[model samples]
Target: MLTIHVVSHTHWDREWYLTFQQFRFRLVELIDQLLALLDADPDYRYFMLDGQAIVLEDYLEVRPERKEDVRRYAQEGRLLIGPWYILPDEFLVSPEATVRNLLIGERVCRRFGPKMRIGYLPDPFGHIGQMPQILRGFDIDAACLWRGVGEAPTELRWRAPDGSEVLLLHLRDSYSNAAWLPADENGFVQGLAELRDSLAPYATTSHVLAMQGTDHTRPRADLPRLLAAADARLEDTRVVHSTLPRYLAAVRDELGERESRLPVISGELRSSQRAHLLPGVLSTRMWIKQRNHACETLLERWAEPFSAIAAHLQPEILNLKPLVDRAWRYLLENHPHDSICGCSVDQVHREMVTRFDWCEQIGEEVTRRSLQAIVQQINATTPAIVVFNPSSSPRTDLVSVEIEPPPEPDQPLLDEAGRIVPYRTLGRRRREFFGMEVDRDGFAFLVAQFGSTGGRVQEQLTFRHAEIAVEEGTAHVHIVVSQREGARPGPFDEALEQAQALLTDESIQHYSVRVVEDEGVTIQFVARDVPPIGYTTYTLRVGATLAVAHAVAHAVAQKPVGATLAVAHDRATLAVAHKPVGATL
Candidate 1:
């Protein structure tokens, strides 16, 4: 009979320099107490290690003898594997940072003993899509995690958008919280008993009783008693202290299965949903938007100041390069899933707003000096101002541009042609001018008039396609409304007719569609109102210019018009729209 292997881990969220002496004292005391307890037990041993304790280099150097023992214990496979250093927040970090942390952790482990195969991330706030590939790159075979499951599945597997497979063994819900904050020995025993009984129904020869470290503020006196109780319980179940590598090896041998080709990490797999399986869906889109906005804001504010400082003291602030690099890396990691921060949607939004403010501050300082050098170098030429509107679609051609004016009230300003452009009076002493209209792509060119008072000059510019040439000396803009290529008469009216056709179709009684020009098409399907076990289909024709703004479906096609857009029934969300040339869609 295969014995039940029990694995225990301690996840110490490192706050080294911030907490300073207090943190060191807490860690040292915990280690001392844990080591004493483990040394006293001959039958049972504690697998203890700090979580991302890379910053403990100074303390470790002072205690050479103890460090040697730790190294020796690791060589004998007593110490479980973790990352080289502490990762700030798994969800908040970039894929590269994650991989770097893993590599560093593995390197540290190799310094003492053998390579670690299983990655451990007991609690990542949530999972990121790019993590699987990162794990695979590090040669990690499996990982453990707890927070992702709201509901349990029968079996576990590594999943991603690309269909890569990894072996997954989710932590049982009751056992997960119980392991950390066990109520009593009886309660702990009961939870373990339930887990054993649940596994009885499945074909399992061996099992792992994984638990957390008995340190921290959480009282866990039940662990020692529960370990003793399990010793006397089942015939086939033998409670042995195990690490991830040992446990994975035993499970693989017991199951007689070959090693999986996929990389495994600790998090919820996104591949289970068909919507994520689609091609060209990058996980970093949301992060990219936040980063781009933050970068632009920084460049605008501090570029000049930063540039002047660098020029004045050439190599004086070179040491600050590491700080800048670290800051950028942190931003890259946390940029993704900014929407999923905190416990709820509103809380997440609040957190994002706060972080965005921090990013803005950092950007302003960095850009101030950088831009000063640029201005000095480009002083000989007329500075061209470029504005960009970042959105999925085009905006109204008209936009506002505000610039600083000259100090003198009567200062003469000349256009490229040396002509004084006419201005509209905005206030008692201020004046305003209108520029060309900007098109959907948000690109426009305008000449500014020189004026005194030197405060700020504001103007509204309109954008349009270049092909629709404006009359000489006049700003004549043409608007192009997107419509289908072969649609007769009104495309919006044709879409409404198709929507009405679906309403009359007998096969699609469960579904309904309403066409709203701005919001695209609205689809509603009430499954409970229809037959329980049957499926239905509805079809509608939409103008080629029309796109799917949002959709939701169960087993059937909720909106048959989705078919015309080449959308599959299994997709949870789809955004289909046409894009202008040289624009991001």
Candidate 2:
């Protein structure tokens, strides 16, 4: 006879075909009903919260009074929440993001009660190769997933690239096998038999799992009673209500002596043998992918390491942990399976842009503040450029910086010991602008006026020989406008006439052209052997033999990791055809 462990749960996709709020409205309803059902029914032993902790936050945001009720169920082992913040697509986001998801998920879940320890990835489309190694860090020994593998048993040992292994429970008939059962005993028994028969071949042990859930599905309040009635009608199976952990424990006990004999699967699971892998999601909505990578790189590479360095050097002056944490939370919200996989509705991806912006803003601000704090500790007196290498290995690459008051074309860049360094001037530009103060209404009026006047205030002003210097204004600084070198026929005369009237009017004050003659030249030079995750100092010398020249060569440039030199084996002369005079390799 087959022994079936019927696990009741709901797979929640926060956003997909519907926007987040639209889906979240239904989420609130589902949770509210589930809470009431758990309160009334002692027979309802377990209900999984889709293997995510964020749903709790989503629910509590609307029903703040039911916080303790949630904590009660979670602590009582009745409602399973998390092993992940969100069930993300394993391939789209970075590995660091996945780790952060786990870390934040566990942390958030522990705030209410104990988190589900199993690595529950029921609907991730596929799985990663290094997932076993990642789960090992959290001491998660079991993973239940549905996709990304060839023909395999319901239970197997999944080994990572690092040789780390986890007990894998394959949902042979998908997570929704027993999702919406019939009300009658005969229908329930027939469905249970079919589910058992399908999963029996894959089951190495007598205990087979029947996940009773699907995407955004509500928990079946009558599942426990139906199982009880079906147990009496079923001829060859004994069905019982169970949780994921309980199901895994039973399977483990069933395979106690012969656990090692279970089938072993390794690496990434992207097979489409049984389920649709949907590989095209990787390339779709590429802008979302690009922005995600950009934000991740900013936080992981620049903001995080530099902030740590600053805090270590000046703990009293800087504590950026909170800001960095906030940034990560914002970024992680975009890593969900449908959202990051680029398969969600247009509104869903559109909302992701704002989160990305917030993440980037926080990261950039923290980086600026951290760098300023670190620079305060430096003892250098003369004006010098600080080149920071955020990489682990020593690097000898060309670095570029813009110097104000334009360094002379003949002046050579110098190292710390006053040694001449080879350098080239890329370009030089003179920048100037103005500033002013205005109120909110005045700001809006100016914006409207600018729009009405053809959105080319700069072009209009440039043609009038009086170039505007500010584009927009803040509440504290009103009427700040700027313009660049462009000429077109517009309401230039009208704008100039209004400006003349305003100059004579008594209300407009602090109207000044704060010209900043930033005639800076952008210079590039090879910074040799910059220390790993450290900084190097460089300066410009007034008088030195210019070792660098901007000569255009007609030779092909080969891409190499570092400086490469080719030697002739037998006194062979290097020849260059159609090369510029004074050009050398």
Candidate 3:
């Protein structure tokens, strides 16, 4: 006789704002109801809880009582441990986070019963590149997932990118609606019969009938009846209700000593072709970009003050390690798939942007106060000024700085002359750096050297600006660095030559310089900042030498627009237009 396993899952969102008392009450109520139902049949003996819910529910206190009942069921070889918890939106969570959560769940399950070997991720919107390896690393022999498997073959086989073998059972999209109320029971039964008929040709091989749904919110009245009806119809065929672990074991037993490699197939839901289903992927990327930009802005503006303060004061004050950790956790909790599949862009924007804004505000406030304290302390040792740029984009123009003295006069601060000294200019440097010929708009560090007894004290200072001069009619380049005086120019020159060669070969169209003189040539060198989170501004200078013109042409063609041109020939100034001459031109 084929063994039939009944698996029921309890799912709850981890981020709901519920008090401890409310969480306890809900856990107790759900367990009580589920236990009462399970007591009715010896065959009906398994319950799975979402891992996130178990952690958020805080069931530690009542776990002992629940454990006794679970042990009783396990003693009868009935209760099976599932994934430590059902992680919501597996795609959005980092691979490390997913693996850690699985390990945590395994630990939790081991405390209750034997460790679970099967992996279950019912809600990953789509499979990522490295999931199969992660699952196999955790000793999870099989995985049951529903999303991303649109219209693909649903047989068990190895599907990981790294060529690791694992049993994969895809849940049919048709059965997904059956988990909710108001679904047609007759239609569901017919669907099962239809599936059985379709699989008749493959009767020589064993098949798994997988179904996934939430037990927490599902209508209890209709489930038992639906199961009974479906079971009766599927009895004639070799249908068995089995969990992922049991199914995998069966496959292993049948295919012993045989190769299990199979091609990876896209299992995404086809109906999700609409834009709403993928807004989370887009929104999450946008959130990261926006938050990074905002934080970069604040840091650039106050980098001098903050760095000086941090250098002198205790490391405990400027400790951002905890904040970064919290941010990572927040990212895991509010992942896009956790909200809803096929959600509107506007809705995702509202939710993610709001969270990013809040995070930015907190991060900015923390940084601002810490910088203030640092500035206060560093000003005593030497004159110091801090600048804060809170814009999402980089700033190019010179930022003014105000130096101040410490509040305590009795602290006995001395100047270079062995006398009391007031505020003074430390030094100034650009706040940001970019690889290309562009000025990055961000925070800068400036320190003014004080005059000492040895003629004039040369204080060590670091500057962000660098210059590259291409000699007339020669490809050899000269690099002058304002910072890192000891930096070797030979290697940089070689690297620049290599870069130019590659650009010439690949982007040759942008290599020719065109002189356009229309009514008086106006060659404007417009400094364009990088897009969105622009860190640098590039000033394209076009000069009249053949080499310079060639370089300018390449740079201008590569530049967005508004590059400056210098006409060397006596006749009129050189005017260069970005637009190529078409038939109309």
Candidate 4:
């Protein structure tokens, strides 16, 4: 007998053409209806939450009152939630990010219910090579996916580079194949026949899967009745509501002895023949990719290691793990297939910038604090430069250090040993501090430079005035500014007029001052033997030298009075003679 497992699921792209908040409003309505159906109808069986745990958080954020409803449905084996935080694009993010995605997803899902064990990747552009091994490490033995595979049977073994394999289930056409199953008796009969005939040829066993929903779609309210009609009308076929896990279990039982004979496919699945890979997303909105890599590097390479070192050296230091995790969460929010792939609408990508900013800000501050904590225990009275190497290999590289009070242009630096360090001055620059007093003209220029209007800087007087500081205990109001690329000089005219108008209106009646930049010298010196995952400190010494004496060599060679030249070739002479028979030379 043939068994048709109808899996009801909605492939939720959290943010695509619509911004997250906009799509979130729709999600609220979908879940509200889903909870009602699952509560009222026992035969609805199961509804997959797009194989992600993040959707639950998104849902609960708006429907806090429905927490128990979600918990009840999930715990009762009727709602399949997560083995992934979000279905991320396999190639865009770091391998570590992928691991964290699963690791965090598993933890969050298990809190209220049983987590799905299958690697349920319904829609990623392609699958990665090591995915099987990664899933196996997490105790997952099966994977279901929709794209990036060529012509093959529905069931096969996907192997990782390390030889670990998983039972791979291919969604041949799409996850939306059975999205509109017929409701009436005649329509059901026709639909089941077509589905059975279409899928049976590819099935390794007598079971075939029919996914019953599409993107952001609610479950069919009368799905149970529809399945019952098909079951009764069909001959020698059992059509029932089922989930992916149960279907896979039945397939395993059927293929018990024939499992080894299943075809094995390995490595990354990025073929474009079966489905479009959307490869351009890798290069589109490239700034987003750049910022993402920077944020990941800051947290993983710098903040994390320093925090670990500080925690071990100074137990009394403030705990930074919470802050670090928060930053990581912010970063991961942008890792979804649609979000990080840069395939979403303008507003969706725009919101990603703010999240990246928050993540980077938190990571930078945490790294600075951790290093400061470690520096406090260094037991040095004079100023010193601390160079840290966060990689596994020892480093020998030049490091730039900004010196206060402007050092001599040719000043030599010294290490812990009394040896002179080879150094050169890159140049000097004025580092302006925030909240510094500036004249009306300078204030206007700064405003025009940093502020942007409509996400562009081409128009004058268009940028919004973000902030203006009125200083206390000083006769000056502070205007903070930083240099930005593509900012023009003439746009400051309107900003100047606005600042003057504010001053005349008594907003800064008592304040009148001019800004002056501070001078600092930047010097580069070679840092040697910086240990892996460790730090080295260097000191600047004035007029310091080693006591060892050096001897000078005086030697020269004179050309000989007579020169001789010699050339050697073969002693025997050769003649250009041709010895050919029929062929022309």
How high is the CA lDDT of each candidate model? 0.41, 0.78, 0.44, 0.77
List the candidates' TM-scores in order.
0.46, 0.79, 0.47, 0.78
Candidate 2, residues 445-495, lDDT tens digits: the string is 654665466534443233222334333331122222224232223334555
Lowest lDDT 10-residue stretch of candidate 1: 512-521
Q: Write the per-residue lDDT of candidate 3 for residues 82-149, one digit (tens) a residue.
A: 45444645544445556646655565566666655666666555666466677789877676666666
> Against the true structure, whose TM-score is highest?
2
Model 1, range 364-440, lDDT digits (tens) per residue? 55554444433444422343222222232333232222323211121222223332211212222222223344332
Candidate 2 overall lDDT versus native: 0.78
Ranking by TM-score: 2, 4, 3, 1
Ranking by lDDT: 2, 4, 3, 1
Off by over 4 Å in 3: 1-6, 10-29, 39-41, 50-91, 156-158, 174-195, 198-204, 212-235, 238-241, 257-281, 284-330, 340-585
RMSD of each: 21.4, 13.4, 19.0, 18.2
Q: Tens digits of per-residue lDDT for model 4 on 1-585? A: 999999999999999999999999999999998888988998888999999999999989999999888888899989899999989988888888889899889888987699999999988889899999999999999999989888888999999999999999988867888887677778877887788888899999999999898988888888888898889989999998999999999999999989889999999998877788898989989998899999988988888889988888887757898899889888999999899999998999999999999999999999999999888879765678788898888998868888775543223455766454555667656543334455545645544554434213333222222234455522443222223333223334444555555544444434343332225667777788999988888776543322210100010013222222122224221111111111110
Off by over 4 Å in 4: 408-411, 429-519, 546-585
lDDT of candidate 1 at residue 467, scale 0 to 100: 15
lDDT of 4 at 87: 91
Q: Report how far off residue 455 is in candidate 3 (Å).
A: 22
TM-score of 4: 0.78
**Cα TM-score of candidate 3:** 0.47
